[model samples]
Target: MTCFAIARDDLTSPDVLDLLRLHLDEMHSWSPACKVHALPPEKLRAPDVTFYALRDGDRLAAVGALKVLGEGRGELKSMRAAPDYRGRGAGRALLEHLIAEARTRGLIWLGLETGRTVPFLPALRLYESHGFAESTGFGDYVPDEFSLCMELHL
Candidate 1:
């Protein structure tokens, strides 16, 4: 919420990796191990993925990624705001940045999978406000009770 900048992350910074670990831990807490699709650091560095970090000044405020699925489509990955930055618009800032990047890269739509539980309500609301709606599973994901898929047409 205070002078944050969204920039492409190389996924090698110690703070970025620590935040990613926090994101993974939170995901695992809300869903089964098999259903947790948040990418690991090595996977995030894959050729098709473009990771991002939202820095509030020198501190990392949040992180997210866009994984090119080819054919004018992409998937949103690892959208998480640090505890100290949540509810202060850090997530929204990062989300907008990714959507803009997707558009810049010529992606027509963006897809994401998140938990369907009450614990995930805030995230669901955030995505919905940005025009993401209920959708069938994308990528390697499958439709299931614990999983909620959404898509935003860019």
Candidate 2:
């Protein structure tokens, strides 16, 4: 079995930067500019956001972020697994880590927004498998045809 390390990342290194670019590019490809909600690396540096990376040895396999929405609410952001690592459990591992982090912070709710397009079906399924159910837009988000929102109560 491949051992993966999950840790907080500063999002400045070259490999992590490349992974972020790929994630943004794919999100843009699947959704229009107005519908693309994935945060840029710089925006994720905000005090309320915690960014993490999952690595298999020196290879960066996946990345994800958790943004505190206050009042016991949290949002999952920018979750993406490297193409080569897809279906190999990296995404799931990263997501599980984020959920644990949220619980550790005493968050009562965890929400996320993902594209409604076919490209995001796997992601939707992944979230569903983790006990997230479809939910209305939360925080500053508004309902839109291209976006599917889901939340889990911790």
User: Model 1 clash tally?
Assistant: 0
Off by over 4 Å in 2: none
Among all windows of ten consecutive residues in candidate 2, which has the lowest summed lDDT?
137-146
Q: lDDT of model 2 at residue 114?
A: 93
Q: How does model 1 score by TM-score?
A: 0.97
Q: What is the TM-score of each candidate against the true structure?
A: 0.97, 0.97
Candidate 1 Cα lDDT to native: 0.92
Candidate number with greatest TM-score: 2
On a 0 to 100 scale, what is the lDDT of residue 4 in model 1? 88
Q: What is the C-alpha lDDT of each candidate?
A: 0.92, 0.93
